[model samples]
Target chain A: MHNAHNAKSILHKISRAFLILIAFTATFTAMILSPMLSVNVNAYTEKKVYDYGDLLTDREESRIEEQLRKASENCGHDIIVYTVKSLGGNSVSEYSQRAADGINTDSDGSGILYLVSINDREYDIYAFGEMYERIMSDRELNRLADDLRSYLSEGDYYGAFSEFGKRVEKAALNNEDYSGNISVRLTLSFSTLIVSAFIALIIVFCMKQGMKTTRPEITAGNYVKNGSFKVTVSRDVYLYTSVSRVRIQSNNNGHRSGGGHHSGGRSSGGHHSGGHRSGGHSRGRF
Target chain B: MTTSFKCACCGADLRYSPGSGSLKCEYCGTEFEAEAVEAMAEAAESDAAGENINWQHANPQTMENDGSTCTYSCSSCGAQITGDRTLAASFCPYCGNTVVMSDRLEGMLRPDYIIPFKVEKDAAVAKFKEFCKGKPLLPSGFLSSGRIDSVEGLYVPYWLFDAGVKGRVRFRAERVHTRREGDYNVTRTQHFMLYREGVMDFEHVPVDGTSKLGAEVTEAVEPFDMHGAAPFAKAYLSGFLADRYDVPQETCRPRADERIRQSITSALANTCRGYTGVRPQQQFISVANGKIAYALLPMWLMTVNYNGKSYTFAMNGQTGKFVGELPISWAKFWGFFAGITAALTVILTLLMNYFG
Candidate 1:
């Protein structure tokens, strides 16, 4: 009986040891292999939606994420929509940049980020890498922000995100670089130059006229005798009336629709960890 | 015959002091009333005529000529002088003495009235400098004393006219009104035919009587105070040069008539107020009881030379009005043009980028 009890205790001890060892080995294996698997997942499928603020439902987030992925595929650039509960002592710009660094995993490091910070009540639009080069000017970025401002203001996050994806896809597909429209730029430049030339001509002409002081006298009003003018006959006869109408012109272009306190700044291109992010960002309360 | 005024206190030659109504001697500083001097000269002339002396022939210093140009001997220096027949008074080039060619001022060549110089030479020079002060394009050397070739006071001849002008003027006038309805603009206009007739009198309308002076420059210094004019007196011409009417009265009548026609048209147009696009259609005018009087008005004439070109300036001696054309610097003009164009272009470009 004594031998049997001792053996049973030994068996219990080895079993406990073996269980602890199994737990530790499993944890160690997970620690080592989880990162490798995660890297594989990140390489293959990048998450385009991060909804920490709970502003969007699971279905809506999924829908938007899929839409963004499709748009990214269409445009050959990564696109993301990230929402946060708070900025955690960092500016919306800094937080968005860090998030973009983690999210955009493409080899080319080309992506666009639409970030929302609920606690700060602010939003940011940042474009980097190849996207930055494609959207060349701040004016085009402002135009994009203007399009989304109304939707965001109305608390329509899904619509705003959806519309943003659609617009990015459409803009990329059209491939009409706003800054690269050389004809329009040249026309505007020539017009400004002509107006400036006209103004200069008028100034010089007036100065030239100032140099000429001689003028021929064409009236005898000075020599007219006072109280000597008389009127013998006066007559007036009316003839006819004419009327004309013209239509006033209206601008129908859908631009500059929403009102917001938008502020913009130059982003350091190729200076951040996201890899050659040479673009601008506009931030404002929606 | 030539006449020269002499001071009574000393036998020195005298000159009419501007704004003083008197002749002053530069040597003795003696002042004599212009009227009293004229009276004394007339008495001497009558006495000499009563003695059967032909002053034109007896005066050995006098020379007569019937051609376009006349030669006279200066009383001060006995220098022979030749000039245009219309040169009534001039300074002798040899001695700088004021000489009046008496033959030029006799009969129809004499002026009926004279407006003496109220502004002196120093005052006129100061005015010209002030006039040159604010002009930016004037050449830097144009105001220098060396560039001022001459400044001379001359009594320019003018013909003054008095007439009654009778005229009728017709005009096509329109009243326009515009209003906006919805998105369209409607403009309505009412047209009418208007007629006006009037008889007006004009007095002392002057026309330049010398072809030597441009009508444009002379008329620019016009509206001389006719009330200040005095009866023609040779004494007034002692210090300044003078000219007789080389342009006859008949030749100047058309100018006076044209001026009257413009005045009548303006007067009629002024009556048709509260209307736009008032255009004169037809006009008929007649001048009746037209009378002409010759007068000598005072002016200070200056000539400036810059870059081998001469520019003339004139000042109304009675009113101190000055006028002249200035030179332009093309370098400064183009520089200003470039600077303004660059600045405006940059500004417009920035605006378009922000708002386009």
Candidate 2:
């Protein structure tokens, strides 16, 4: 009966909440659609770059898919590709430098790939993919791939590539040490230290409280002749004259009546018990 | 405080009968041998023998009853009847004790301690009478017969154990804060600790030691005074039939432990509240059995016959603490049941219309 009642109440509450939600949504829709709610429009521009590659060439599509898939998997990102026809051997360097200029980069000879990016690290892989493998030797490219794979697996893709770049620069700089970035490592280590300290402090405090209190014992005895709730034997008997009365006469007659033991001792301790001040139990505000 | 040379065979108001060198029952015309009587007198000194005496394997003895003993029976009765030596027997207030058989005396463990009956036979009868008067639902003829079954005095055996209990409790407490608009994330983490070294003292934890009786029967008569218990003697069991310990000490210890642990858990909980980041972290308790003593207490038990059912009543001999059930009137029971159902329906309907 109780379970049924609870279930009914639960259903009622859910339906009531749903009704309230619908009512709220209706009011919000009316307010949002009102003429007084002005739409904010900002100036924007769009340019479409059309592709006219061979539509039925399987080999060409497969090759492009392979490149995009490799970039996506290695960098933990999603990469989309659209086929383009040849433009009289327009070199990647020419287009990259032009894009870099549009973004106001100071380096004239440096190439900067412009790609719509969902994540910074993944976008870095796209630019690295177009250049590093093609420009560098097989041994160096394999080494960089291994490093990037490990970094992405550990959720530190950007950090790993940044360190790789710094290492290459250092090697070129005649073995000079250059600390490119250390913020992420320092932040992680410091947070771990703080968490450990808090746990240790709580444990110590509980132990102290437990050791401090030593109140005199209070024992709540058990019910002896329980269940006499309805029936029990009620009659007095004596062993000699009657069969019911039982008498307990003290005995010093037995040889093995093991004598009782009695001892008393006092110890020193400041034990606070019963109801202590809740005042001491506050987490200080920083 | 009192002296008496009463007949051991038949309890009769005795006066010194001439020509008889020993005690004699005047009504039954039975004589006790002088030497045997003297030995019986020495039995008082033998009480010390009862201090640690074991009655586990003692032979069962049958108690004698006369034609006065009548057993009543009823179809709806659930009570068992034992006969008393009396010419007048009332309807088995529970089931008219219909079975007329020889009364039996079973001996098992001798009680080590006992609380003597402070309420006399007359007082007990008066209490029962008074009890019946208030039970208006009972049939009017039930108590009018005025037949008082021999209110044979009895010493019921009990075991008392003392111990110390220690426990460790583990709990989790969480405090939540929200910065509603920007970041509505709930930061909840479990904090663990070793809640060690809490101790409790347990006393008079009772474990029923009679194998013949069920635990339900024992629990029905709870809360005997353990502090006032005196050492046991066979003399206290006179005139009443008693059962010895068919159930052993070790066997009953677990029941006591279970009760004590349940009690301690609650006691520990009372202190567990009122902490900000405090919840039960861990919990464990150990109970060590301490001094164990046997006790026998006084009780006035009666079975009653009502409508078609039998109800029982127990009056504590020492403190007059009464516990037991009285048969409920069918009319009143159905009336209350219907009334409650109707009330619940009305309340639920109103709540559903207004709030649901």
Considering every candidate listed, which one attains the maximal TM-score?
1
Tens digit of lDDT per residue, candidate 1, span B78-162? 5443445565535542233445554432222467778999998888878777777776656454565453324667778788887
Assess chain B of each prediction and give its TM-score: 0.65, 0.55
lDDT per residue (tens digit) for residues B177-250 in model 2: 33223323333332222122355665566665555334543454556676777766554654443434546676
Interface RMSD of 2: 30.0
Each candidate's DockQ: 0.25, 0.01
In Å, residue A273's CA in model 2 sits off its true spot by 81
TM-score of each: 0.53, 0.35
- The C-alpha stretches of model 2 lying farther than 4 A from their native spots are A1-286, B1-108, B121-153, B169-194, B211-217, B275-284, B289-291, B305-309, B336-356
Over the true interface, candidate 1 deviates by an RMSD, in Å, of 29.4
In candidate 1, stretches whose alpha carbon ends up further than 4 angstroms from where it belongs are A1-192, A240-286, B1-108, B177-188, B305-309, B343-356
iRMSD (1 decimal) for each model: 29.4, 30.0
True contacts kept of 1: 0.70
User: Which 10 consecutive positions of candidate 2 chain B have the poorest summed lDDT?
Assistant: B51-60
